[model samples]
Target: MAAFSRTASLLCKNAVRSESLGKLNNFCTSARGSKSYQLVVVGSGAGGAAIAARFSSKLGKGKVAIIEPSDAHYNQAMWTLVGGGIVKLEDTYRPMASIIPSTCDWIKDRATTFKPDTCTVSTQGGEEIKYEYLVVAVGLQLRYEDIKGLTEGLEMDPMLVSNYSAKYVTRTINAIDKFKGGQAVFTLPNTPIKCPGAPQKIMYLAESKWKKNGVKKSSTITYNTAMGVMLGAPKYAEVLRGVCEKRGIQVNFKTNLVEVNPEKKEAVFMKLETGETYVQPYDFMHVTPPMSTPTELKSSPLVNAGGFLTVDKYTLQHSQYPNVFGIGDCTDVPTPKTAAAVASQCGIVAENLAAVMKGGTLTRKYDGYTACPLVTSYNTCIMAEFAFEGVPMETFPIDQGKERQSMYWVKLHILPRVYNLMTKGWWSGPAPVRKIFHLGLSKQE
Candidate 1:
């Protein structure tokens, strides 16, 4: 713990400018109605933390304020491993106070209203914050309650669980342990989820676990996805199709989870292509629910027709408000929502937003770089890194499409370390690492 503390402190110092690395308590609890900042970040998640660190260092101390309500910040990307009993939930989070730059003001509250017309927002704490530049990184909100009987099922039966939330993740392990060889069903929802591969990742893990428990012969494993393809990338999709076939895992495409009947131990799914519905009995079920921005935030003027921030897909700047930028799952970026994408977007938002603050026009663009480690088995993974339209923008010299113990080992061991650096604003995505691996020739053209 001491070594981790020392390394984290050193990294934090290097990441945050020396001037903004002090432990000065500039945070305000005053009932003051009017407060102002050079920059006000709406959420303290990955995008907000990185962008705030970027400008706080350049702008010096006390110019940045992050609006977040949580006392603990989570690296939510690791929740899948927690569900699979690979990691503990406590290991996935850190104190928000520790991750947030000490020099910046932490307005610990939820943002209730965004008046972009005046560049002002009202918080639930009854304080109003005004900003010259704003960054919105409020991640997606899960809608587990939207599905009939789902909430009750999650509460009543430990056998029914979800990897999407911390509360239900441990139940997945419990369900696996108590399984007596029936249907071990899993599902993917219709709406955009934070990590697209997470729904099925647990399925693969459960398969391995069941095989280890000697229940593989009797248990029927199934993955029901709302999308037509196994993965958004065609190359990975082709590989995953083979995995499903070889593992004898039934995959139903264009199938959506609509309802769960906890009493009957039945799960109902709607076939998106055929407009048909079916119910299947199950001893264990893992469900991923539809996700969206909070109802109020989605309906606000800050959002586009699609209920996400109306930001340019390239620049991540608001189309309507030049001074405003969007990042993370809440934005209308045409890429799969992942922590890796947010990591790449952080630098872009910081650089481009700084340009805007200097009375300059937007120039930086995001190349849609995102990574998803498809855990095909307990000990192997296929690292899928790409930009728009499934172009093979990989980081390693070796073929990333091939499942290897090396990739899986990194997924379990190294990526969590990278995520720790990322949330603390110490590390950007592997763009530099990728360039170095490509000998500086793989410049994202």
Candidate 2:
């Protein structure tokens, strides 16, 4: 209780500082020459945007800068719905300027190199930005080129689409609409992906769409995944397996997509255990490409042997560099990489980094809390919330593993609004709500 009170008091004092700092109108917008700040945040995705907002307010104007090359910010989570035809692609985009806090200097450039030893970052535009503290929030890079012929296939074959990419997401529904009752295949890659549930989510929605269009009896639906289990969480995995069995969806585990023959309309897969290759012909296919940390990060000294950011899974601070922190998919946190995970990590990064700035002990710790609303149909979803090691940390009192229309409603309508609030530093996930629902008995770590 004493620890909690002290941490709360520290955060309160920081909030007061944020209010005062926000009033300073001095902002930098240049991409050339050398610059410096108290803090420099790389990448402008979920983790980058939220953390930048928090510190840009807390540290004052001209004290913080964000280096990113993209002009538009996207809520990538919505791409699944967009692919399902539940929402338009335009609905998920906000101009990057609008999302970035006014107090922070937006250095519109890509980070090409990181020199943690000197607290320096080199941008592609020949600018050197130095900082007292650094936050690496650069998200994973989707490697569509990794699979043989996959890039050409996506370009030449109208039936080949992936919900993972914004360029190909809209093509998903179109391909589904064009299908005239043939083999429909969906694949999960061998590498870690942003949303582990997304590769299968589109399958469920497509199956539902086929049923609605009277093609369910004629079309065959198959889910080919690289993972041995349906989901990481055993509780949710069991339920998902039952759902697939009931829906007659064939599950092929440990099978990875290795290549796409666009001319032949076939996908080649390799078995992980036996190293055996097989081919599946398809009329329509959804592919989740392999992903990795950005090239700049992978080659840097900040990453681990696996090329992911080397941060303490609990503290989110770089193992070697005390002033360096990481968030989102780039970090080697042993949790499913999702926006929900990023939201939970944002406050931890903010508080711990603030404590570092104050020469105080880091009190906050992240428990790997993440949520995945598995949309099973047009109106039903299973809300899976868990902590480290797949321990269920549900927010509602009711059974969240069960498919419910209310959960789908929340996913469809409420999550996006909450996401926007998170980018603006106004939301910090549903921890408080979970505590209230569980009567203060919810797992804290």
Score candidate 2 by TM-score against the native.
0.92
Candidate 2 structure quality by residue, lDDT tens digits, 310-392? 99999998887777899999999999999999999998999999987776778999999998999999999999988899988
Residue 202, candidate 1: how far off, in angstroms? Answer: 0.4
Candidate 2: regions farther than 4 A off: 1-33
RMSD of candidate 1 to the truth, in angstroms, is 9.6
Displacement of the residue 216 alpha carbon in candidate 2, Å: 1.6
Clashing pairs in 2: none
lDDT, candidate 1, 13-92, per-residue tens: 34222322121112111112278887899888878887777777788788999999889888888888888888899999
Reference-based lDDT, residue 232, model 1:
86
